[model samples]
Target: MKKTARIAAVGVIATLALTACGSREDDGDKKGSSSNSDSTSSSAPTDASSPTEAAEQYPDFKACMVSDSGGFDDKSFNQTSHDGLVNAVDKYGMQTAEVESNDPSQFKDNIQAMVDQGCNSITTVGFLLADDTLASAKKHKDIDYSIVDFAYFDDKGNNTAPANLKGLTFNTAQPSFLAGYLAAAKTKSGVVGTFGGLNIPTVTIFMDGFVQGVDYYNEENGTDVQVLGWDRDKKDGSFTNDFESTTKGQNVAEELITQGADIIFPVAGPAGLGGLQAAKDNGAWGIWVDTDGCVSAAEYCDILLTSVMKGMDVAVEQGIADAAGGTFSNEPYSGTLDNGGVALAPYGPNADIDSDLSAKIDDLKQQIIDGTITVETP
Candidate 1:
């Protein structure tokens, strides 16, 4: 289901203040507690198993999840991953639990709480929880563990995770490249910008692809469209340093706007919402990350040009299903354009791209899928 929570205009500043101070309620305090029950109802099966039969088949199995600081309401990866857990519960009639970490310090405890609850499978959201998830998986060799946006390999590209742990990662650059091209095509001021919550690979991957896309557009159309934030070569650019404050996001976006950026892309979870608000105030277009902004944050649909999406929900659900059916493996799952794992959302109603530009984008997508185009991450 699409999230309906909206940030009130009057509460914007106040909400940012609370998030910055980490004053939000700790939903993770309710450890080991089931948050949902079986809600599926279907007729008895004839040959193949029905929904009711599937639920009965896994009556003793339990799946759980732990969210990063953004929690499940960020309308980004956290919420999308949690949705996958919910989908698994509905399909298998399995018990489920979740913990929301409000700070990095809570990661270890929140994951341990899932282990203590006798969870057969656990999915931890965000790259920040990698270490804690790995340690937990090592200690509990029988429990299946998966982490989103992170992998277990080192710089040398070797497998370093335990056999019970799996990585759910996405090559978001493929679609972000498309977003960059779209921004270049629609920009009236000939400048676009992008910012991240932190300087981590998960965040910079989006910025890298965006800048490259703009560069490709310039080469193709002989247009000198400039990218205000992020320099792909030096691998340095604008960042909020944290993923919780909208105020900071707005301030950075405003700086980009002052420099003549007509379009903005913010890859900073809930903090990105602040950037969108700034775009609305300044009459600039925005490209959302992680989930479709029109569906997850419909409040900003009027200003959103599109979204670079990651299929976290589908990956998480598949992970849980594997564990429930005793087919769990530690193999890493990488989402890419070729696999329908990452994609560019449909243009918003306000987007005024012509048929020619749309067709070009479609062709670019096919090229990426067929290996004719390679979207590299810096």
Candidate 2:
């Protein structure tokens, strides 16, 4: 049997220096790039048991997942979360099922299909699916349900989820702040930019941290690197209005480039690929989100500076494991700098960042982890 491990709440930061190649065969059907790492546990399982053994161990346990509108190939959170479900199937030999939602209208039906299929634990990807996931969880109180990028709380700050539901959320603003600082340091034009797929909290949280990081860099270095496409105070900025349109992404990026933004950050999932293309064509640097661009979209490696990543796969696999092992809890799992749940990818090989700036970014990470610095969220 594969040994079960709880995802740690705190740990030493994981090294993220990686190199890989990826391809995009179609503009509309792009898939996320790939990378590898163990779970947060100090002694995470290193080998998988035979399928026979796995089934025998968890004969009645079946895990299922539902993807948001971006589908599993989004090259962002959906892909990463799907990877976690696959990891759990491989490690635990548990039975699994999955469905993709091509639109918001399918959320309820997709989740209901999993429940009807007799899934003991269901994991839903994306913040947009929260209401549907909650409804399903409430109706099927015996089944465990976990949603990515969302927590079960109200405006007044009270937990409203059923005892069987858990949230798999990440504080990505922390790492995006680091990415912003790096962009500020590397931009020759003295300007950087960021845009999101939507104005939602999950998307804007990245923008919030990034703009703040630029501000911090200006404060410390006496440099006034301006940020375009986002204004933190107004809580407003540019957005693609959707996560699947590369055309919109590219157009928004071009607008920022035209405004003298030499570095562009796109938090728009598959749509962000267009932004990267825009940066490459315009001779600007690009910063990717959710996964390392070099690994997820290697064709743009030459122009990518780095990536702000959330360890969704690690958390998702562990959440399923908890359900399978009878150790499930409804407490929300928040990925943060202190917990190795979110990180800034190492500078790309062709990136202009130097040793001094790299070291400074590392110092910033440590400070954030140690509470010497605080990164606000939207």
Candidate 3:
């Protein structure tokens, strides 16, 4: 998934908290027990030979998860990952558990705690767990582990892939491209903007795709719409480097607005809230990321254009299911627009967005999916 630096850092913070603190919950806290594992009621198919049925192979296996700095209900990354694990539990007849840590030192302890609880497969969400995940994987060779939005490594072996561990990522560029196209079409000032929490590849992927989308629109429609905030080719983009600071996001949005950008896309986590606020103040609209920005940032809901969605929820569900069936692979799984795992959110008030423009964008999406058009990733 395309993660804003703020969200990524929170995951690490949570890991630290878990390892440093004795226990995530308070003393005598016994609420950390399995909630439910009723398989018959799930959406999973019943045929034993079916692809979904393979998850039943490990009926006795227990699945566990660890959330980074953000709580499970962070309305973004953590919630989506948790939903996937919940689906896996109901489908595979497996027990489920989770630990929420807000500090950085808690990662190793969280992984170890799940193993100690007899969990067959454990998942660590967020890039913050890279070091801790590798350590946990090496210390407990018998346990299968999966880390989302992060890769594990060993000094002597291939850092890209490791046995007994799997990595999950999404082709975030595709959806961001769509978002850029929409932003360009919707801009009244002929200028659109975007910003993020960091400058890493995960974040740049979104910026790169967005820049390409604008170029596509200009080339195809013969329109000279301009992009503000970030320049993918020149590798210059606005970033807060902190997800929690709304002030930083607001400043970036204000600058873009001053430069005539009437539409903005903020890829920051909670910090995006500031961008949303700035859009309102500037009488513009903003595109949200990860989750439905309108819903998460309800205060600025009306100013939202749409969202660039990455189907992390579905990917997580599939990953846990694979582990339950003893079919987990170290291979990284990629969620793309074609798989319904990622896409642009439905247009909001801008739904009536010039039918011709919409049709052209849709055709472009298909061409990109069919490999007729390429959306490059940097």
Candidate 4:
């Protein structure tokens, strides 16, 4: 994912670019741009997508990425996936490119663009593309395709059910356990909170591991720290339905703080920024998601107790390596804390957490990784 600074930079670029475009648009309007609009709008849809014949006709040897609707500068999932593509380019000298989807309808168009550009292997970076990923794979059967954070299956054995496709997923709960335990240990208010961006499996999987960690801690250490935001026991915790609403995130965190929760983990994307701000203002601590918030968002970095680190880079690296070796498998590969795919971000102010508690959490981490302890995801 992009660092917060980079996202901020992108915002500036978008603004400057928009201003320049506005000026040009104004001048064009005076020059009778009605015809230009008519031609552009009329031709846009047909030209938006490359034909299957064109994709089949192109030579394929490069790697490409079709980001989720969030785009490459979202500073979260989309950005992290882009980092993986960048790594592939640097290490393999592989030609690489990326396209952002503004909505679900653009999924196929984005994929087709890369395919027509002769990319042999392409990565789709979100679960929202589940249907489109499979459909495109069938249409372009000869291409090697990989989808991150999603899986798809079709009843037909024709082009859609190809063996050349690989789906990348991870056991996010392992690192989430560490986040929950850290929140539990660092809370001065004796209560903690967590919320998700959406109710999807990818997001709730984190909650599952977090609840297990909190429950395990209370059970083993006799700490009656009440989790305030989401009910880990029920497996249905606080969720904002969308990831872009900062006000909702802030409100949720505020309520949790009112209930004595001094630490909050918000698994929402940019919306989580609100939770962090709330934590800071309300004298609470917070946990970040996916990437390292401490480094990603340096302004609020210090307030981040820690982050649930998911090794998207490692997973992406493995996918590219597999494609190169011609050994990519459709079998879902899961990355765990032990497998080096996920874990807890380094402690900041909570670095000096209770030695005994820290050791216990470490032991639990190892147990979960080694199959001795099971961390259930809701």
Candidate 5:
């Protein structure tokens, strides 16, 4: 039987560092886990998770997840990735574990802790974890690993998936273009805006597609609906600097709204909630990312327009299930429209979108899927 140890919240990086050091030796010698330590008031996991679930159910397969600095309750991207692992926990009745990195520096140590705890397979969330996940995968060849939003490439840029590691990627630009078009068509103000958590490829990809969508709308309708916060040709735009601060999110959205943007899209993960709040406070409609905001961030549902879906739940669930069934492979999985890996969420039921516009949106989706339209991302 696997022992299930309860974990309190892990609040700070310093405390987690100490715990990692103190628990190091014993960690490698143990087969069980210390679950759910949310030590910080600010970094706390909003909902408590079962420290360990039915370890005895799948003795040979133990799964784990390591979150980026944003933690699991970001209510958007990271949460979607984590949900996949939780799905496996419920469906396969496997022993599961998770560690939320309160800081970037803690990523490696957190991964080490999961390995020490004997996680057979581990999934690291977001592009920020790519390098650390690669290093760990190299060091621990016996365990399987997967990364979300990053592809494995050598220093020379050759596509590669190191031994025992898989890369989960998405062509989200495909669907985000659809969203951009929607915003352009629906904007009562002639301007819309988008901002990211950082300027990484994964974050900027959405921005690229959005601006292009707006541009496409202009060419098609001869209207000058402008985009704020991003300039695709320059590959530069607005970034919140971090994924965890709602204040920064609110500030950015407030700034863009003040600049006459009535439709807002925030890709800042947890911090994006600040934008959701700002949109509500300032009379702007919001477009969500990763998961459906109306479902994940139900508090802001009434003001949500739609979401550029990443299908993280579907992808992560598939990865874990593949590992559990002994068919795990390191081949990269790219979520594209053809395979339902990426999509645009439907407009809210009570939204002002008329039947004709809705029909047009539907037509655009088919065009993209059929390759009549191509969405590009940097």
Candidate 6:
């Protein structure tokens, strides 16, 4: 079942506040004590086994989570990861703790706090925390670590994972390709666009797939549907370089709209809200990333066409369960279309998703999963 429990972050001055003071909520203050874990109820997990089953395999476990700058409330991947952590807590009745980082600078401190609290497994959300997570895992090999939207690439460029670390990543390009195609087909202006929080691999990967999808749509229909904000071959575009500013998102969205793009996808967490505001102002459509935009950024539901979903919540929860169950592997958990790790969100009741185009997208998704289609990323 698709897991769902939404929260998020937004704005610029708030960014400054986060950097100065992190939001630390001790959910596990009385972990071993009887508490309600019944709040978790959502879609079926991609895996056959649930957290309850996984917990049954372990003797004792304590799971803790560290969020990126957006905090657990960013209403994107961070929120999804938080949900997973809570699910494991409720499903397994395990001890749990959580730390929310307001800025990148606090990643190490938040993680260290969790470790000090005696957490055997730590799940760090977001690609930004990769280096810190890797360093922590290496220093404390006994503790299991899982990171979302990131896989380690050592200095020597070896294809190896640490003994106690699980890097949870997704082949988002495959499903993003589908989203791009949908945008291309649905756009009234014959142009669509996408931008990112930073020029990092995690953000650009989505842009890459989006451009490729648009290219595929053009090829299939023999129509000229232009994409802005990214050049797949050149691998370049407008980047806010920060995940905290809606103003920047608004600026980026306006720029793309000015370039004739009627559909815009902003891959910048809370900062993407700026783009949504711009979309509403300009009377354009948007494609949200990470979660169901209709829910996370519900204020702009009328403008959201769909979302490119990366199931970080399930991946994180599963990794913790595996570690607790003594079945943890250094092998990274890769989210893919075939594994239900990633996919495109439904065009909400407000958006227009026609029957023919919808069917085509469905076929394209299966084709990508079946290996008939391959989406490459840099």
* Candidate 5, 263-358: lDDT as tens digits: 899989988889989999998899888876655676776787777878776778778878877888988899887787887765654456776777
- Model 4 scores a TM of 0.78
**Which of candidates 3 and 6 is the stronger one according to lDDT?**
6
* Candidate 4 wrong stretches, greater than 4 Å: 1-60, 152-161, 232-235, 349-351
Task: For candidate 1, write residues 68-177 as lDDT tens digits.
Answer: 88766677767777777766776787776666677888788778877877889999999999999999999999999999999888799887888899999999999999
Worst 10 residues of 5 by lDDT: 14-23
Ranking of models by lDDT = 2, 1, 5, 6, 3, 4
Give the worst 10-residue stretch by lDDT in candidate 4.
14-23
lDDT of 4 by residue, 1-378 (tens): 321111111111111000000001122112210111111212111211221222222223466777776555554566566566655544555555556665567777777777776767888887778778887888887777888886554565233336767777778888787677766667677788888878788888887777777777778779987776566556577877767677888988888788788888888876777888898898778777776665455456657666776666566756775776677767665667766767676555434555676676677777776888877763
The CA lDDT at 198 in model 5 is 94
Candidate 2 on 232-349: residue-level lDDT in tens? Answer: 8898999999888899999999999999999999999888988999999999999999876666677887788888888888888889999999899999999888888888766676
TM-score, predicted candidate 2 vs. hidden true structure: 0.86
Off by over 4 Å in 3: 1-60, 103-105, 151-159, 294-300
TM-score of each: 0.86, 0.86, 0.77, 0.78, 0.85, 0.83
Q: Given candidate 1, what's the lDDT at residue 186?
A: 92
Q: Backbone clashes per model, in order?
A: 0, 2, 15, 2, 11, 10
For model 2, state the Cα shift of residue 375 in Å. Answer: 1.1
Off by over 4 Å in 5: 1-57, 154-158
Top TM-score: which candidate number? 2
Residue 33 miss distance in model 4 (angstroms) = 40
Candidates ranked by TM-score? 2, 1, 5, 6, 4, 3
Q: Which ten-residue region of model 1 has the weakest summed lDDT?
A: 10-19
- Per-residue lDDT tens digits for candidate 3, residues 1-378, read 322212111110111000110111221221111122222221111221112343565566777787776556555566567666766665666666566655557667666766777777788887778778877777777778888776544676455656778877777798788778877777788999888877766667788888888888788789999987788668878898866568998998899899998988887666677888898998999877765544444455567666776666677777787776768888777778787666765555433466676677678778888999888984
The predicted structure with the larger lDDT, 2 or 3, is 2
